[model samples]
Target: MSQPQPERGHMMPRRTFNRWVQNPVLEDYALRYAPKSFRRWSEWTVMNSALGGIAYMADFAIGGSVALTYGFANAITSILVVAAIIFLTGIPIAYYSAKYNIDMDLLTRGAGFGYYGSTLTSLVYASFTFIYFSLEGSVMAQALQEFFHIPLAIGYLICSLIVIPLVMFGMTALSKLQVITQPVWLVLMLGPFIAIAFKDPSAFSHWVQFGGASASGSHFSSLEFGLAAGVTLSLIAQIGEQVDYLRFMPNLSTQNRSKWWLAVMFAGPGWVILGAIKQLGGSLLASWIAPAMGSKAADEPIKMYTQAFHTVIGSGYAALALATFFVLLSQIKINVTNAYSGSLSWSNFFSRIFHSHPGRIVWLFLNVGIALGLMEAGVFGFLNTVLGFYSNLAVAWIGAVVSDLVINKGLLKISPSYIEFKRGHLYNFNPVGFGSMIIAAGVSIAAFFGAFGAVLQAYSPFLSIALAFVLAPVIALVTRGKYYIARENAFEKSDRHHEIHKHSELPNEIICASCEFEYEKVDMLYCPFHKAPICSLCCSLESQCHDMCKAEQSTH
Candidate 1:
């Protein structure tokens, strides 16, 4: 409990959050909606920040690893197939998130999961953050070791600790950091590839013919393709990170509709397109260097790019310098995003269960600390093994949410038209999304561990997606959508405007009695226990009241 207790018989005391929590600009509305007032960033600004996270070099490592294991054909096919799936599913989720101005965890609560049901998803999303953070940080550590002769262990510490201050400022600082670095990142990333192509045109043809060590030997095997796709599918949770920034997009209107769609489409699902390209590029570079470096070391991004840069630079030291700088820039750009999003998910998860929040900044440190531990534990060594196992749960979670968004809400019309994230208005658990995710994750995990035969084991993540997608709608129908909304919203009018317009029929701003801070109407709700308007974060932390508002509303 970060909040201090109020005197007995007194109204809920105004919370005294530390400086970080008190400033919405730094906090970035973690654990709640991004209000209309706070969401003032231009469409391109938000999109750039969201897309900046894709600068991570792990895609190169994963691509190189997959190519070495499955040969060129299977690796290329699997990467493209998974990218297409990620893009199609990202459409509805991105649109709804931007329109409603809520992050993935809050979106999950209203989409199919209930108030407390999304706590599980918060954990899932948090895992994606730290896992990727460690991967990216490991790349940066390798660069430090190569350039400065720093020990790998100390390099990991330096890389992990440096991003804390950058992410502590949240979106406000990140947006500027991303915009400033985007051009330099682009030039550095593309320079080596161009140099390699120009230095020896024959290298491209040789790369295409590379069979590596795979049994298939440059040919496609269904089993190998499935296995490669499973590893790539682990990136499915990346949509959550994209929407964390997308939630701050300005409201769409006739004047900005075209720009808004372009921004969302490019920044949201569009990230996978570039990601797939990077993976292919990594695969190509691995092939070029494999004869000299050996396939065992081919998956390292630093090694792959260093060879590419050497084709043009000619000087070994100069090539290494350029490659090291590129790696450091890419790692920092992505890790800050990873740390920021992880803090939001952790804040959502812990605030719901423990009914306490020291601040988003506190959780930021916790997320980075966990990632640092993973880096020290050598998580990078088990990259494919870890991502392969994780893809099952990640696909299951995303599949359930996508089903709820496209099928249940859009096609079936069983769920609400708008997202409702307030604690007092939702059930603690909704079997539709939560149950589907659990069943899907459990079965797929069993299959992944060889509970099923070899073919099923290879395609376990795909199986998770299919089962969760089909099961979500079935559970929603069986429950008759009753769990979606526990009661009528107590904070807004019940007219057509309220249902149709996302933020209509509410005051422009209302002061939260608990925090005593004025917030946009959408983030505040009526609290019968306190008999005042309470913001969502404060309502989530008010354990003493025990949800009297929902109980009282049911009697009426």
Candidate 2:
């Protein structure tokens, strides 16, 4: 754990941006890295919280939506292929953020997008949270309507507001909520499946026989498969939420070698393995119930779970109660994460644009408010269309980031091995990530809108992925990786370079002129504009200063 260094001199007291984000319990270092002291939880504890968000019943809803729109075979294959892509792409992102001890936003700032460029991706990521938040909240509202007869509109408000306090204290409260409820969620989730399997041995065969209404019965179309895959692919952004917890993992070492790898594997890319299973489960449950519940009801978690639970509990009211409880558990568990990650994304987005941050909590309400509006506007009804269009952008962003990590950083050496996320060291935009994302998303969205043809439209996700993968390196080579970095060795040139820590020695302190606050030696910088030391956070939010700190020629 790194200790805070107290300094001899302090500046005139003004509000510190860091102060807005410095809660030992609540803030969870939203604006900075998760140093060793704050990352005190065991690997398993973090893993549980990370996996808890997967409790969202939307996987079932999405799978069913895709299966209904397409067919069983295509839906299953799409879920599997998308899961493989998500898991593979997630590996480098999860590993980098965890090892570097930075959040997803900070990682984005370094991974070829630069400081402000990542702001666009921040909005993209924030949208993912709210869109999913509304979807999950709608499912919960349905549960409320089922068990309590709560109006859907009122239910939406109740669902949105319920998660606010749980997330205000950050991961401290969230981690516990997930851990405590996980056992019951698991049992309630599995009990119905087991009961159903034992009761009807031929049910699985029946599920395979049932094709969607629009389909040639029991046949698979390439179009159906592509649409199914595109819808499922929107979930690529789930890795960002996983990275939120992964960043808190204690630094890996030889002492905890096995545990470290286990944590990274399961909490990182391993999340998709479970996601795939849940999608399949949703598809099966929907396939069996679609005939009885109407096709639309198969798209609702409350309905699907209730039908399954009835098979187990054998009483209508009792089954409804149990299913509603499971839905609430799943929704609350995931909504908290949605709220938390949305807060972080909004913080990054507004702070960069506005040059100041009110705090992450402010954005929390804003995010929920937007999601609430969407729920009222019936975003859930258009789930397929919304997610299908949204996946083009989502895949574009993730594909760009992944391509940079695997191709540019690994093969081309067009980017750095280590992440340098500080604002002064990054350009406003890097063509490698920014350009590729736009081009990929543009093409995919065009196809999604039926610009190319029916076949290409269905395969829009693959087109987005392919273009992003190809363009990242091509742009890096064309630009010669110039915009990828602002100033070479800029951190070393800063006033308070990192000092080697020794057990017997006290660390140095430096004060920021703008905020007049003390920071550890490594956090301070010599601001060329202010002509005095400034901490990284202040330097980051300093708009008037521009890039004056690095406003010089670079022969390096």
Candidate 3:
């Protein structure tokens, strides 16, 4: 028995937007697999781009907010703990995603969650992009308000729209932007800290004891530490953004193994090392500037850096200019990543459900549009509440993915060693990842609302991690790893013909039956309906195919 072929006359022409959406730089394989030929960038270039998105100013605001709400001792302790966990969990996810040359959505799919099950995480990731974009844009608008007296409302529009052009072309545009600004961003970000230390020799000593409006500000409290960590933990999902570029990393090899590991470690989990420092800096700067700028204003990065620079520059106008410039540059650098990742997530989310992709660029505009709406609605004011609630979902999502990767796959060896993410060959849902995330998120979110107790509410994120870690393997064991892979790779013959695609295979191109264009075999699959090989892009857009090939296989 063999798979059936569709009647020749019934085959419909391939309807794909590849012409518009498949710009190597813009689409970057948002809706399909990133084959060997497309991943041509050097390790340094991809690493820099991943690292560039880490310049987001929200960390400053988050750092200051947590310290103000909780105390410096608690905030600092929680920050350290969260950073450690984020780094540890990020390593395997980053390594696997980079090695497979797939984005986070695809990684999640093969990490235990099935094709459609990954959509929940994709939406969660999409929401994160828009939420953080709005926050960073708000920070930029605050700078506009301070420097040009632009109304916050109008400035929000300008800040939100400005990054659209920069992000339109995807990694090609963003990588260059990140590299060019890397040096300047570093100077501005670090210059203020050095200037503050030199100008006020006692700044550190005083900051250590600053009360920050909270009675426990200068000292640690377990309750406050848990609470602070819960809010900061919302950022755990940021690894997905880093993965968006790291997926572009050139394949690891014996020659580049050291550099590959370095790039993955630094750009992946390593972003948090610098992020935590900026947070602490923000907390310290907030205290130093509070009396002059007012408590609420001190938490703003624009104000924190302005006061820090005022001492060194010795002029209010000059300091304001420097702060405004830094804010705009930092915001642009990060928002581009936010938008790019959002587009990828949205493309995955919609393409799966709707079975259509207008283009990754279309989703880019939609993502920015949603973020702009949230910004205009003053979502910035509820940052704490929003982040606290969001942490439950984010922690559960990341926790489940990490559990499957580290425990189910690594320790138990129940799931496949390699990611198997093609939709044509993956189950619609997998209980191992899906069920664990649901239980974890449900219980954690319930606790967050005080359904359990005040103590439970404070430690909801930890509970989510614990539950996810415990449940993932239990579920995998119970399910017998049946859903980890739907079937053997469709392209492989007898499991012996499986090919590990290499960049050197660029000249070995397959012709897309409908498009009449050549592409790497990695992106082409046999189309039984057309009785010829078709590119994945065309396979995706062929609404008329109706899984004829898979159905035919089932009957055999």
lDDT of 3 by residue, 1-556 (tens): 1223324444555454556575677777896667676777899999999999989899999998887778678888889999999999899999988887789998998888897899999999999999999999999999999999999999999998899888878888889999999999999999988988788968788778876766665887787888889988999999999999888888776688899999999999999999999889888888787767777787899998888889889999999999899999999999999999999999999988887888888899999999999999998888788998999999898999999999988999998877777666667799999889999999999999999999999999999988987899999999999888655554554332123533333435667776656665455567777877677667656667677776776676
> TM-score per candidate, in order?
0.96, 0.93, 0.94
Clash-forming residue pairs, model 1: none
Models ranked on lDDT = 1, 3, 2
Global local distance difference test of model 2: 0.83
TM-score of 1: 0.96
Please tell me which model should have the higher lDDT, number 1 or number 3.
1
lDDT (Cα) of model 1 = 0.88
Off by over 4 Å in 1: 1-10, 495-507, 553-556
Model 2: per-residue Cα lDDT over 1-556, one tens digit each: 2233334233444546445466657667676656555677888998899999889989989988877777777888899989999999999998887777678888888787888889989999999999999999999999999899999999999999999999999889989999999998999888888999998657689778768763656577778889888889999999999989988887666577699778878988899998888888888888888889889788899999898998897999888899999999999999999999999899888878888877888899999999999999999999888999899999999889998988898999988777767777788888889889999999999999899999999999889988998999999999988887677543354322212211113335556577765555445555656666667678778877668756753533
Please, what is the whole-model Cα lDDT of each candidate in the order they appear?
0.88, 0.83, 0.85
Better of 2 and 3 by TM-score: 3
Q: How far is candidate 2 from the true structure (C-alpha RMSD, Å)?
A: 3.1
Candidate 2 deviant stretches above 4 angstroms: 1-20, 489-513, 516-524, 553-556
Q: Model 1: per-residue lDDT, tens digit, 1-556?
A: 1122223344544687888887887788998888766777899999999999899999999999898888899999999999999999899889989888889999999888899999999999999999999999999999898889999999989998999999988998999999999999998888888887778888789877778777989988999899999999999999999999999998777678899999999998999999999999988888888889998788889998888888878899998998999999999999999999999999999999999988899999999999999999999989889999999999999999999999999999998877888898888899989999999999999999999999999999999999999999999999999898876665565532134343333336667778877776677777777776778888899988887877776787
